[model samples]
Target: MKAVTIRTFGGPEGLAVIDVPVPAPAAGQVLIRNEAIGVGGVDAVIRRGTLAMYGFEEGHIPGSEVAGTVTAVGDGVDASWVGRRVWAFTGVGGGYVEHAIAAVEEVFPLPADLSAVDAVTLGSSGMVAHFGLAHAHFAPGESVLVRGAGGSLGIMTVQLAAHGGAGAVAVTTSSAERGDRLRKLGATHVLDRSGQGGGADAPAGYDVIIDIIAGADMPSFFAKLNPNGRMVAVGAVGGRPPADFGMAMMAAFQKSMSFATFSAATVSEPDRRAVRTAQFDAASRGELRTVVHELLPLEQAALAHRKMDAGEVFGRIVLTP
Candidate 1:
């Protein structure tokens, strides 16, 4: 099988496509002939060797999610899974290939009407947005602000919050055109990437903040929360915040505001599967939106990463094999 692997660390130039042995499914796993693979921020992080401390090395495949047909199953997996269309979580690698392996528990059956690109787009990101809201104890009437709202995860947060009956759904994005596009997707207000309104005054404060960019500016967003507001940090694509970023919460002790980081990794397998299934169903039924920026051939994996690095991608980029 052919797979794209990181031959070295740093630039996307290091990504190379090469032939490799087809991996066999182990016990409780299934082999998928991948049709669509999701390219995410985590992939770029891995390619840059940012995860070196955690044992991510050169020659690693950097995709975490894929959607395709099951070719075979290992011991303990049901035979019925063969030839079934499904979405699978490939953990941190192995998904950027013609064939990928995933534990049976990580696979979910796709709706008949759902396309492979849509399946991969909403598979893992939808889980994060759904659980992140729950983690923050979000209430339907509360206002929401999704920071870094251009990518798949942020885009999911915006629509989910609006569909969940949020009073106001605000987003921070790069361009006015993109903001207008997001408005059609349920965003009530759009702020620039700096989290500031163009001319109109920003909302008094947000009741809940879904922050994907948690860097030095994190403290500023922390201050925008209303009383008893909760802020959930789901990604830190902008780099880490200051060492004393938490001090702002303490400084405004009377507000009862809170801050915490969240990841879908903390959720139980059953819970993750259930939520992902629901999201896929919702999308298939047209109750939820799945934004796919583009579908590229698997060999263009490096080009996909380059677009992500340049902030040119507006939504999920799917690679077809």
Candidate 2:
């Protein structure tokens, strides 16, 4: 088998493709012949060694989600899974390969109408967007603002909010053209990356903020939340905010606003699986959308990381093996 690994940590050049022995499934696991792999900001963070504290290191394969066909099942697994097309979560590594292993419990059956590219796009990201909104207690007709609305997660948040009955769906993006693109995706208003609302038509405050970037600017976005609003920070792609950032929330004590960080890990496995399966079904039935920026070969993993670092990718970049 061939796989991409981080030979060294720093630039995209650090990712090198190498030959390796094919791995077999273990107890409660399944072997998948990967057709597509997802690349996102977290991959770049891992490549840069930002997550080294979490056990990432040299020679680590960096990928989280994949869509493929199950070639075999391990002990305690059902034979019916073999030869089934499905989406799998390969943990934090071992996904950038021709064949990957996933726990049987982490694999979800795919709709025949969904392509491999679409499966990878909506599989993991859709789960986060869906659960994040629910965790924030978003209600119908409430206003939504998605910070860093350029990746798969942000794109899904915009569509879900609008389809779920948000009165206004606003996004903070890099350009007018991308904002225009998001509007077509159901965004009601656009804001620049600096936190400036698009125009006078923009909502003065948001009822719910689904923020993907949590850096120095996070506090500013927190301030935009309406009284009694909830803000959920799901990703820290822009880096961590200052240690004193929470003080801003305390200062607005009278507004009764709330802030908290959200991770899929906080959700029960059964709940996550159910939500993911429903999202895949929705996309297959045309009730949801998956935005893919480009498709690259598995060998071009380095190129994919470079694009992500340059902020050139609008949605997801799928690597076909």
| lDDT by residue for model 2 (1-321), tens | 889999999999999999998898999999999999999788888899988998998999999999999999999999999999999999888899999999998999999999989999989889999999998999999999999999999999999999999999999999999999999999999999987967899999999999998888898877898999999998988888889988898999999999988988888899998898888889999989899999999999999999988889898999999
CA lDDT, every model vs. true structure = 0.91, 0.93
**Candidate 1 lDDT tens digits, 1-321:** 899999999999999999999998999999999999999988988899877898999999889999999999999999999999999999879899999999999999999999999998988888899999999999998999999999999989998999899999999999999999899888999998878883465587999999988878999887889999999999987768999998989999999999999988899988887788888889999988989999999999999999999999998999999
Candidates' RMSD to native: 1.2, 1.0
Alpha-carbon TM-score of each model against the true structure:
0.97, 0.98
TM-score of 2: 0.98
Worst 10 residues of 2 by lDDT: 194-203
Model 1: CA > 4 A from native: 198-201
